[model samples]
Target: MVIRSRRLSKDNTYYALKQKIIDSELEPNQAVNEENLAALLGVSRTPLREAIQRLENEDFLVRQPNGRLRVASVTIKEVEEVFLIRSMLEGYIARSAAKHATDKDILHLTTMMERIKHSFQLGDKQDFVSYGFEFHDYLSEISELRTFEKVLNQLRDHSLRYCRYVSMHGDWNTQADEEHNYILQMIADKNEDGAEKAMRDHILSSLSTALARIKGMEENEIDHIGP
Candidate 1:
């Protein structure tokens, strides 16, 4: 029982730290103080070190030249790599969804679309993104490819940091909504090719905008890689 409790505590510490990095609460390239974090989390150094090691293994944190751990910073190379992979995989998943989705699945996606639109109207960017994830998850689930869904879940989370970055600097929400509408329409029509194309186009377009904004920031001597 003691062993199990320690393991649970370690797992909780891992996820909490991972969430802080993912949500950009910790900020990219921000130095991590192990002692300070241990105090903040109300955990001892042992469990905190274990959790930090796990996050480092997962590429969410990196060791700097000074041997300090910092959240991994975004770069043009990473943006290109992540979006390229996501476009291909998500496109395939969208195609599979169109081919296999039932009436209920279609209705569920439609309802999610409405919720996303409402969120946008209310300027609730977080809710809009959350509902969009729900829509994607449902589509992937209906595709009946468990392995693909697992890969996509990680890819989407990493890509979301960039998505939120774009939203902060541009009017990407409406563009994404328009693209989503096209993808959803294709899925509803069971047009596998069209659905795949729409999904790929959406991802590539998003990548283009994010890259442009990053370039602009670099030119202005401001690195916008953090929240």
Candidate 2:
């Protein structure tokens, strides 16, 4: 029981730290103080160190030359790469879903779309983002492609980080809504090619938006540092 408890503690610590990084509560490249973090997370050094090691392995944390740790920085290249991979994986999944989805799946997705739209209308960006993820996840679930789903899950946290940045700095307006609706329509129509293309286009559009925001952020930082 003691060993099991310790394992649970480590797992909890890892997830808590990961959530902070994903949510940008621990901003990119922010320095990590072991003692302070251990205290803040209400865990001992052993579990905290275990968590940090795991994050480092996942590329969510970086160890500096001086042995300090910091949250991984979000880069334009990383964003592009992640989104490109997501586009391929999700596009395939969307195609599969269109081929295999039942009527109940279609109804569930339509309901989720309504909730997403309502969240946007109410200016609830957080809920809007959450619902958007759920919408995609459900489609992936219905695809019945467990391997694709597993791989996409690995990228989801990183995708969410960039998505949050975009949501905070840009608008989630009619274009995004239209893109989602179009994807859903293709799925409902059981148009496999259309579903794949629509999903790919939607993801690539997001890449464009994220790239713009990231470039703007870089330029702003440079301006701030200039003479």
Candidate 3:
């Protein structure tokens, strides 16, 4: 019973800290003060340490040369790599979904896409993002590829972090709505090749938008810092 309780505590601590990092509440490259973090999270030191170690292993936290922990900073290289990999993996998933999806699955996906469209019309970026993920998640499920789904789940979380950063910039909603509709159409038509291509193109397009926004942000920061 005691061991089970401790395990639960550790799991809870890990998820709590992970959520903070994902939501940017911790912020990129922010220094972590272990004692203060424990107090802030209301967790004991042991479970907190365990959670920190887990997050570090996941690349959400980094240990500095001086042995201090900090949230990992987002980098263009990481973003490019992550989205490129996602394009490949999710492209394959989209193909699989095309090959396997039922009429019922198509109806569900169409309904979800309607919600996404409504969110876009309402200028509700948050709900648009949420419904968009639901659409992709359903594809992952219908793909029936357990291993691919597992890997994509982790990549999706990383993508979420970047999406949150750049989602407000540019004509993200317009581009996303069009791309998502195209992808959905390809899947509904059972065009496996087209679905794969559409999915890959969508992800790579997202990468382009993210890179542009990040570069613009960096340039603005440089401008602010210069004399």
Candidate 4:
């Protein structure tokens, strides 16, 4: 099983690097030194290159003018484009979830929502984002649409850094909490149309906030995204 072990190692390395990018530890447009990253991750060049290649295919890393790799930067146009598609996908998922979700699912989401609300009040944006994702993940899971779930997960991961960035700049937490509560209510009431509409509205609202943040940022100022 040596080969299998190596495959697992490569996958682990890939996800670790991807998470670093997503969390902005490796900031947008920041240079990537292969040797340094290999040393830091404690992996050899071969596996590191393999992981890097995968990230390149995913657009997480891009070749720069100086022929070095850097984390991909965000754009207002891309944010709007991604969120528009997300609105449609998540709206469909909410519709299906409202028709299929059980009491257990509802209760779990409600509890998670309460935790999210509490975290928001404490100004813990990180935990708030985490719980917010968990809430959406649960709804996606209950929808039982594997293809839709997979695509939505990828889209969410791509947009999460931007989402967190804009969220930290304003009172998005309070507004998002209210919107989430309304969505949850729609799901609980089994109002498929309402659930769909609520989910789309919520995503569109976040997109509005993200677009504002993107507009305010200077191209060189993206690295300073966090509070």
User: Model 4, 90: alpha-carbon shift in Å?
Assistant: 0.3
For model 4, the stretches where C-alpha displacement exceeds 4 angstroms are 167-171, 219-227
Question: Which tens-of-lDDT digit does each residue in 1-227 have in candidate 3?
Answer: 99999999999999999888877788888998789899989999999999999988889999999999999998899999999999999999999999999999999999998999999898887677778888989999999989999998888877887777676554474888999999999999999999999999999998998898989988997999998
Candidate 2 lDDT, 1-227, residue by residue in tens: 99999999999999999988887888889998899889878999999999999999989999999999888999999999999999999999999999999999999999999998998889887678889899999999999999999999999988998788678776776777788899999999999999999999999998998898889989999999998
Per-residue lDDT of model 1, residues 1-227, tens digit only: 99999999999999888877777778777888898788878889888999999888878889878889888887889989999998898899999999999999888898999998888888877677778778878888898778888888877767877666656655554788888899999999999999999999998987898899877766665544544
Residue 208, candidate 3: how far off, in angstroms?
0.7
Give per-residue lDDT, candidate 1, residue 105. Answer: 87
lDDT comparing candidate 4 with the true structure: 0.87
Best model number under TM-score: 2
How far in Å is the alpha carbon of 124 misplaced in model 3? 2.7
Q: How much lDDT does candidate 1 score?
A: 0.84
State how far residue 219 of model 1 sits from its true place (Å): 2.7
* Model 1 clashes, total count: 0
Provide the overall lDDT of each model, using Cα atoms, as 2-decimal numbers: 0.84, 0.91, 0.89, 0.87
- Scanning candidate 1 in windows of ten residues, the lowest lDDT window is 218-227
